[model samples]
Target: MRTAAYVLVRHELRLLASLAMWLARRTHGAGGGRVFGYARGQGAMMFGFAFVCLVETLTMSVLLRDYPTVHQMVFVLDVYTIVFVVGVHAACVVRPHVLDPDVLRIRRAVHVDLRLPVDRIAAVRRELRTTHEHADGELDIPVGAQTTVTVELAEPVAHFGFFGRRRDIHLVRFHADDADSLVQALGQALAGAVTQARSAPSPRPDLPA
Candidate 1:
């Protein structure tokens, strides 16, 4: 029964996502922007969960509509509002990561925006597995991505998590369809940023008397 329900929820979310994508394309035209990475399966699962929550909210609202007590209606409304907010958050999470010239921006499903600087990226490498021994401070955008890119940072970056939790992360891991291509892009961007920094003239020093 649980598996059947899960499948139904996924189906609904996929339908909703398809409609939303179609509307977006019609409004904005094709080729929205260059997206570096996507949550893929992880995103689908989250959207499915969101769809289930939304359906439950609607059902509760309908059931409580005829209730005499005003508090009951208010409570139903509040639950619906919370579910709507969570659904919006899930939609945001399903959006792909936007790659800019100098920064990589990930709009997480949980309402967190992670912006990583290209210059601060120390190294870009591909790992066979997700787990690591020295992964004390690591950030994985979509957890459980098979083709993963491990980005080592030159300096520790403070990342804010859900519920006011903040931690310093030295590594950023994410799954990409084409891990090799992503690595190449990062390498080129890092090299360009480094070269630009080096070519810029330094401030002149004043002679001491």
Candidate 2:
């Protein structure tokens, strides 16, 4: 059930690729992958929340139309709005605790076919840990051992860490258990992609020849 929540959140995030891609292009000059990832994650979460809000609003509107008097309808709508907002807020706040485990499942689903470039593909491991202050938090991943990859979520934010920076403080964490196999698979996939990209000539000059 918790894993399912993470999958749902990630699915919601994937739906925002168009906007994320657009922003990535604009900020390509900023050299902040972490920033971009954070933005994308937050945007995705907001989009999901907004969708829920719209549905709730519509439902309330329909239900209120059947009320006999304006005072009764207004009182009912106000109460409903308050309850709905509070529930949404609480749900969003608690969502991470349920979804963290699903990250591993998502990691395994990536295409390992021969045609895809390995450089463009990366594998992820998610760790879920309980904290005193919060039930669930995120851990940051360093890209290629040098760059920071941001891990943010919809309701509760996770912890972020880079190699050698505050390493001791981690209580709850997720990682690729079979890291060697994952790296090998990703490397092979990348190598295959590189070969294909190189063999196929392209008009663009900036890309690797």
Candidate 3:
């Protein structure tokens, strides 16, 4: 009876662990088993800015309490609400880049969702320069980034930008805290993808043809 009880407890523990993992994945928006990479410095900066905004808002609220006219009250409320919204947006900016087996997904706070296929990548290189001068057909997503990784595509991709403007992009540049490591990992994944495609057998042709 003790042995049977032990096994039952083990099974319940596994079920509970699985439930917790599922909930975590759902909360993180990692539904497809994608790995995440973060811009640590940029995230820190955003959080710091949010904290400053919070302090300023509180100070303003206290200062404006004496002049409680309808107009002044409305202005104060608007300022507080705007700052609160900005802080929330800043918090969301910490969302990491999702790296899938065959794609790199970048999601910005209600601004852009970029999905780049692994097979289409021609090269992944690190740019050490502090400021990058973008070429005419390049799509750049710097987002207050410090380190940079430039991804060259084999062919031009149609990227829809803000305001629904579509443009053909031959290269993409983005920032990451560990740009070198990211480039190395991405290169290895792309190489493996290429090898797999080459090793895949082609469809059989018709005998009569």
Leading candidate by TM-score: 3
Give the per-residue lDDT of model 3 (tens digit) for 33-132. Answer: 3444444545566657767766766776677777778547766675655554453344333345667788876655434567788888899899854566
* Window of ten residues with lowest summed lDDT in model 1: 25-34
TM-score for each of the candidates: 0.60, 0.22, 0.70
Error of 3 at 74 (Å): 6.0
Q: Rank order by lDDT, top first?
A: 3, 1, 2
Which is the better candidate, 1 or 3, if ranked by TM-score? 3
Q: Backbone clashes per model, in order? A: 1, 14, 0
Misplaced by over 4 Å in model 3 are 1-27, 70-94, 145-147
lDDT head-to-head 2 vs 3, winner: 3
lDDT of 2 at 111: 11
Put down candidate 2 lDDT per residue, 1-209, tens digits, no spaces.
34657655554453343234444443221222111122222335545665676676667666776764854666567555544433433322222111111121111111100111124233323323222233333332221122221122233322222111222222222223333443344445445656877999768668676
Give the lowest summed-lDDT range of ten residues in model 3: 85-94
- Superposed Cα deviation of residue 93, candidate 2 (Å): 19
lDDT of 1 by residue, 1-209 (tens): 24657655664464456346544642111134346544454556656676776677667667777774954766667665555544443454345565667886655443456778888889989765655444568877644435377788998888876534688998877766567777777788888999999999998999898
Worst 10 residues of 2 by lDDT: 105-114
The local distance difference test score of each candidate is 0.63, 0.34, 0.65
